[model samples]
Target: MALDKSIGVGMIFIASFVFLYYSIWVFILPFINESSFIQQFFLPRDYAIKLPLLLLLLSGLFVGIFVGKVLIKNQQKQKSKKKSQ
Candidate 1:
């Protein structure tokens, strides 16, 4: 196979989970973890910013990898089709 099926699926799955986690931790939880009213209302805080950014980056990487694998598979398919023709 031009792309490893299990790896491609796994990468996408992992990326999706990372994206979910980032959304919850970075975007959602700060409102809930209110130290004070002002902190909650005005301060847009990225709690654990670096780690989430890293996770976001990793998620992007895995997505890109999955897309590249798909493209490789499509290209191989076209090549096989041309040879058969």
Candidate 2:
């Protein structure tokens, strides 16, 4: 599917949430007491680090798509104006 501003923003929004969740789980939670209720949600040892990086990738993808759309739009506008001349 073509990437538009609206869709790109939505993806970034979701990625933000995932990144936040990952941050709280990875950084803050480690300092908390082991017996704390939040420990119950601790991710598996293998996948814990991977999930946050994956979300980071998603956010980057959204930003790239947004930039790509703007660049394409500007190029097309320039081409159209040249054609009209």
Candidate 3:
């Protein structure tokens, strides 16, 4: 239904926004308390930025996929109903 599609879009939007904010925090927050060398090249520093960015990107991607799937399913069902009618 249209309502379902709208809800899906809204949820995806909100989720993507939250992920973006989280990514910013995760990516940048560590620079506040650590040494420059450790912050730049160490395992923790590297993972801090990379992991959060990857998660953020993947979350957005999956949300988009979920929205697309929902829309497609709704359209197919409606098309089938129309055909039957």
Candidate 4:
């Protein structure tokens, strides 16, 4: 559908914008003068590293838990089916 296509395009645009913004904040901002106006728009340099690392760890933990849960549920279903047979 056209709506779905538009939504996908919008999402991609937003993601690209975020990627470029973060890249600039992390890789380029530090070289700029500490007093520049742009510095005010972004958080302290420490967060650029810390935030991504924290997000990565949290996402990994959630994914592992999700996979474990699904596997457990599937095993339970199989056991029940076997018992019924």
For this target, which candidate reaches the highest TM-score against the unseen true structure? 4
Ranking by lDDT: 4, 2, 3, 1
Instruction: Give the runs in model 2 whose Cα sits over 4 Å from its true position.
Output: 1-24, 27-38
Report lDDT per candidate: 0.75, 0.85, 0.77, 0.95
* Candidate RMSDs in order: 9.6, 7.5, 9.1, 1.4
In angstroms, how far off is 52's CA in candidate 3? 0.4
Clashing pairs for predicted structure model 3, backbone only: none
Model 3 ranges with Cα > 4 A deviation:
1-42
Candidate 4 RMSD to the correct structure: 1.4
Question: Per-residue lDDT for 3-24 in model 1, tens only?
Answer: 7998899899999997776576
Worst 10 residues of 2 by lDDT: 43-52
**Candidate 3: tens digits of C-alpha lDDT, residues 1-82:** 6999999999999999877756655666565666555344335546656887898999999999999999999999999999
Q: Where is model 4 more than 4 Å wrong at Cα?
A: none
Lowest summed lDDT across 10 adjacent residues in model 4 is found at: 40-49
> What is the alpha-carbon lDDT of model 1 when measured against the actual structure?
0.75
**For model 2, how does the per-residue alpha-carbon lDDT over 27-79 read when each residue is reduced to its tens digit?**
78878888888878767555786876897999999999999999999999999
RMSD of 3: 9.1
- lDDT for predicted candidate 2 compared with the true structure: 0.85
TM-score of each: 0.47, 0.53, 0.50, 0.87
